[model samples]
Target: MGSAVRIARETTEQVLAEWGVGPQEPCTGPVLLILSELVANSVRHAAVLSPKVTVIFAGGPDAFAFGVHDRHPYRPALYSPAVAGSGRGLATVMELTLELGGSAVVRGDADEGGKSIWVTLPLRRSGAPGAR
Candidate 1:
């Protein structure tokens, strides 16, 4: 989990930087933690051994779309916060997504035999995009 989190954090930092999101704006701590959690979940439950995770950042002024991919066709459903450890992943993701002033989705794909979980976060009042 720690390794996956580090890779994601590094990748996000690099990708967002390339997309014009500086060190402070798109690379916030809570956002990093949320992504870390998502990556960890994929590593544990995507059901594909040696599965790889990919990160992509794309958006305009209104929002920043963050995506993570893994080698499983199974998609994750939203669970309530009261459901305990196994259920908190998606809930925390949704909370972070909403808190960032944007939306999120998890989709299954048989075409590639994998799943992609994504979230779009908006920069706050920075005139940049959606959240802070």
Candidate 2:
């Protein structure tokens, strides 16, 4: 799981750089953190049913998006109250995403039994108001 997170972070960093999202960008840290949390959740709860996890990244001039996917059929409730340690992962993802003027959604894979949780954030210029 640690390796999974590290690999995902590194790959995401590369992708973001390719898209011209600098390390100092306001949304960069939250994007990496959200990806980490999502990967961790998949390892912790979905590994039994899904041996492989996929991370998807997409970006445009105005928005950046990513998704974590697994073969587990369970779709978590993103806004549900945290059940001790069980529910905080998606909650944190949701919180940071919404705070950055972003939205998240869960999509089921039609050819498979799993799901993908996708998050999209508006891209603000470095010095813009609320950029940080």
User: Best candidate per lDDT, number?
Assistant: 2
Instruction: Encode model 1's per-residue lDDT on 57-123: one tens digit a residue.
Output: 7777555677788877766665444524556777777776776666778776668678777777765
CA error at residue 89 for candidate 1, angstroms: 2.3
TM per model? 0.77, 0.90
Candidate 2 stretches with Cα past 4 Å from truth are: 82-85, 128-130
Candidate 2 weakest ten by summed lDDT: 79-88
Q: What TM-score should be assigned to candidate 1? A: 0.77
lDDT of all the models against the reference? 0.70, 0.87
Runs off by more than 4 Å, candidate 1: 47-50, 79-85, 110-112, 125-132
- In model 2, what is the error at residue 63, expressed in angstroms? 0.8
| Shift of residue 87 alpha carbon in model 1, Å | 3.6
Residue 117 of model 1 has an lDDT of 79
In candidate 2, list every pair of residues with a backbone clash.
none
| Candidate 2, 8-101: lDDT as tens digits | 9999999999998888987789889999999999998999999899999888988999999999998887766753356567777888888888
